[model samples]
Target: MTFDHNPRILFLYGSLRDRSYSRLLAEEAARIIAAFGAEVRFFDPHELPIYGSVPDTHPKVQELRELSIWSEGQVWSSPELHGQISAVMKNQIDWIPLSLGAVRPTQGRTLAVMQVSGGSQSFNAVNTLRILGRWMRMFTIPNQSSVAKAYEQFHDDGTMKDSSYHDRVIDVMEELYKFTILLRGQADELCDRYSERKQKGVQESMSDIGRMVNNVNLSQM
Candidate 1:
């Protein structure tokens, strides 16, 4: 199958600091993907409430869900904090449900994970995101970028300087774009599972049995 339109990608970043390196990294990736002829968008987590603190009807939550459903792929950028992904990033992922009433919003989508470290280079954040991507049933690209000493990597203009780290970011974005294009039209066939289909059939059978039993009981009354 062929894709008729540009690949839509939604980016999520971890951090709310005035000069958040993770957000800057996401911005840089967005620019690269956009240049590659993909539609890119980022979600601002500043106003997003904690996962359980508010109902899903909240404007920010709704917006996030809507974007997730609209995109054919995603980019997740997080800061390495205390040997793990930042809470800001986790909260955003938490708000996105694994399954929304039989519709897996994220399943079969392409994902690319990236991270920025304040102290030294570490894959902690990106590694964690890869795990989340798998749990969400997304096809995470193999290439990932981890920027060390993030503060020094970006210039005062909030753009990454010319360095190997920037090159890695480009590599990752290129891989994501390729994967998104290849899998966008084949997602349904690729994600279909015989086990899930069998389970659904069993559930429908049980429901029918229950209805039949109720009808028999009512006739005797």
Candidate 2:
């Protein structure tokens, strides 16, 4: 029997800081997710050209889009740059839209959000990301982790130091795994019913599938 081992997880980190706390938090989360049996990958948004900076043909933009399509779920991590998620993080989110040519890039995807605060702990970034996730039509998991004064939570060797915080990361990841499987199964059908266009050029194949098209009219439709 072929054992299915793949649960693709895309990790997005905010800030280009050499020692970004947000990146550290993401790394910690990635480690836990991998330990739990999912294959985790991180997005290097720095290489990604902004939404309008380069056209769709840009290598970085294409890279990001391809990654989004391939992943089962995503982990969005950002630093509280101000009282909210960093502009860099917001910019990356902005680049990921529901529509990408004929494909809806983020629609129906599952997401887990996290935040690292430079000062007193806060949920500003995660809350903002969750709102964005909803707008993108992705299913955002309810569990989340926020690391305050994140600088002191990791060691110079890049290992996470906080045990409680580590447990929260595990919780967030497990939730993402469950939601990803549950949502992907219904994604295509969900996209069809919820899409504003309705019918969306896909004529109901069966006479019984549509809004009382009736036997003869359904065939013509």
Candidate 3:
């Protein structure tokens, strides 16, 4: 199916460093997504503070929540730190809860994960982020990318080398596009089933109240 209407994809890069390979990787992925006709945005994590029990209205938190709500899919790029996802990536995930007030920020959305490694190609970071995607109840696609020896994989101008890693990024973005189109309209139906059940219970309770009032009138007569 055609993912028309300009499906939005939010790219979250783990490291805030000026020349972070992960950020460069994410930008490359975004370029591919745009090439395939999707609107992609890379979020700047500099303003996002650590997660806490704060309300959804907090400025940076709200901005993130808004982007998550606006997008049909996401791309998470992080450097592998100690064989796992970096702290920056984890913090961004933590800041985005399953819900923001009445809306579920991640549910019914699609995700693709990528990682940049200091050594050889490693899937550790992407794998961990996939687990987190499941935890957030997001539909994560199967295709992923892990760039090995990231320093050598990218140019000084922030464009990544045209290699197998680039091809995988293209594959993941295309897959995410396909999955997002298939799932977008179902979001409300999936979420509202719970609300429908709650509505039914509320109606039944109101009916019980009506019955009690009828019985009281009869007793008074």
The candidate maximizing lDDT is 1
lDDT of each model, Cα atoms only?
A: 0.92, 0.82, 0.85
TM-score order, best first, reads 1, 2, 3
Number of the predicted model whose TM-score against the real structure is largest: 1
Q: Candidate 3: which stretches are off by over 4 Å?
A: 1-4, 53-56, 189-221
Residue 182 in candidate 3 has what lDDT? Answer: 80
Candidate 2 lDDT at 137 equals: 84
Question: lDDT by residue for model 3 over 1-221, one digit each (tens)?
Answer: 65458888999999988899989998988888898788987778897877785665789888887888888899999999999998888988888888766788888888998999999888899889999999988888988988899999887899978888778888888898888788878866765554455577766555666688777856556
106, model 3: CA deviation in Å? Answer: 0.8
Better of 1 and 3 by TM-score: 1
Tens digits of lDDT, candidate 1, 47-130: 999989998999999999989999999999999989999999999999999888977889999999999998978988888999
Q: Each model's TM-score, in the order given?
A: 0.89, 0.85, 0.83
**Alpha-carbon RMSD to native, per candidate:** 8.8, 5.6, 8.6
- For model 3 the TM-score comes to 0.83
Compute the lDDT of residue 60 as modeled in candidate 2.
Answer: 75
